[model samples]
Target: MSSAGRALAVPAASDIVDAELVNGDETAASGVDVRTARDRHLSAETVAAIEASAAASTRRAYAADREAYLAWCRQEDRTVVPASAETMAEWVRHLTVTPRPRTDRPAGPLTIERAMSAVTTWHLEQGHAKPNMRGARAVLNAYKDRLAEQKDEAARARQATAALPAQIRAMLAGTNRTTLAGRRNAALVLLGFATAARVSELVSLDLADVTGAEHGYDVTLYRKKVRKHTTNAILYGTDPATCPVRALRTYLTALAEAGRHDGPLFVRVDRWDRLAPSLTRHGRTIGDPAGRITAEAAAEVIGRLADAAGLTGDWSGHSLRRGFATAARAAGHDPLEIARTGGWADGSRVLARYMEDVDRVKNSPLVGIGL
Candidate 1:
């Protein structure tokens, strides 16, 4: 077998039998089972470490993609471990042409792209040659090009309307501050808007990450690129009703009442309105006592609050981040300043693209011209 093909092979019973024979004398002398020792040597520590390279959410996504690919391999009686270029090309074609189960619609270009990435990563990690297929790339490119001809479907699907300043105020008003869940939700929304924080950053926050400041609060955020903590100042808004600092303070008071001193700043709440009890006291609790909320749940929180406020549109975790950028630009804040507040690295095009629509409207040549 070729070296690449050999790397993909799982251990067979014959190989194990040979190993047992080789170590049989040692096993007899030591009064220990050689097979057991060999199994210990072949533990999954390496696999665990490789999987740990990705964040939890990314790992989950990759796992699902890998499972799907394996299932396809099982159905086709193909080797997934050392998946050949032809096999990969066929998989891509299958993804693009096959109607999804229980639906007539084929997989979208982006979905296929992500699935391909997952497959590629799986191969590399499993000690197999990367799936190299110009044919697959060409096919996917053409498919994407065809989709691009359709304006609505081709445009970025996540390009939903941003929640502006008034819309955010309405969302805040919709929540009742008296209840624990309400207080947490209100603080979560206001803080997210004020900081323009990604859902991951928002959920990863710990009590120690925050400190009281003269005007508002200073939050220490962990920058993944730098692998260090950088502090951002969240200033208090003028209005008490909409002030993020005030809302945060109220939530902190509730936290104190619950006898929580450390751990995740934002925890989960059950459907019955029961709060995820604090893990500070090491007491048993219903639901996850780990305190930190998942990024997906964080997105749902924003959507649910937005729905309650009578806003009409698809809202996701990206909404808060996008809303902050758009709202900041509309309020006449300098683009560079807004970018800095949102943690955009200098000279990055992300901030520019985000503010492009806002700039087009504000700097339009037809603004003062009569119809």
Candidate 2:
């Protein structure tokens, strides 16, 4: 026979049997079984292939939403399996009527739409030939129109009670400077207003981030969430005329006079000025001597200061940022300039939200008509 034909040919019964089996012995000539070792670890190439098949952020969001829906299904005594379009449509309807947790809010059109998108993504990721989310999509669209109307009504309500910039300034003027804590609180409020920083970013500041320069002190912001896309910059030219930064410098100098260093700039000081790490989420002590501050701590500082200053009207960490934008625009500063200082790419939307028509009324000549 040809060599190729011999290679293709199946072995006879005598040749197919192992020599060890024929001899009634336990071990082969090589004393190792290849099949046993192959079952243990996967090859490096196979591991890399599995890692490459992992889902992106959007897909993960969809999966989370789908899991929420499935949990709801079990609670409602509905079939957990989503095999047909009818079940999907029913789930969409349930989402619209369902009451959300911890609030008086109902699951409106927007919520239903997000749920539908998530469920559809889940089916596609599982390699299904055809997803049955068409009915869910139709229900979502109907709910979305209703949600838009509700949003418009809520926006109109907000326009009626918009706080004036002068009111915020008057509130800041009331902070006491007698005690160390009072002075620190005053400085924090001023810094937040001047920098227009998010509460989280403001509280994360360290002593190393601020330094004295020839003109004035420079404030260095590091890895701030707002400046995530851009390189961190130093804010120079800070003085008393600048408001908050000046107040912060005064507080820092006071700390320096006491020989305090090698710790966070904003430490948790009690009534006696003794420092402690701020309490963490699980009530454990955060012992990082120069560690970052939590967003919750920043919010508490704002609330406490507002109470001490006798300021009213839904104040939170966001109040400082919003107040800064309003105050800057009122002082005739350009929107783009304010945005750049606040770490926003553009300030057009912020200006539109906070700037009233009364502020721009001088551009028209009709105000001088009675002359």
lDDT of 2 by residue, 194-214 (tens): 667766667767787776665
Tell me the lDDT of candidate 2.
0.59
lDDT of each: 0.76, 0.59
Q: What range of 10 consecutive residues in model 2 has the weakest lDDT sum? A: 1-10
Could you tally the backbone clashes for each prediction? 0, 1
Which pairs clash in the backbone of model 2? 190-244
Model 1 stretches astray by more than 4 angstroms:
1-50, 73-85, 102-104, 126-129, 150-155, 268-287, 290-292, 331-340, 343-352, 362-371
True-vs-predicted CA distance for residue 244, candidate 2, Å: 1.8
Best by lDDT: 1
Residue-by-residue lDDT tens digits, candidate 1, 216-269: 899887654334566778888888888889999999888888777888898876
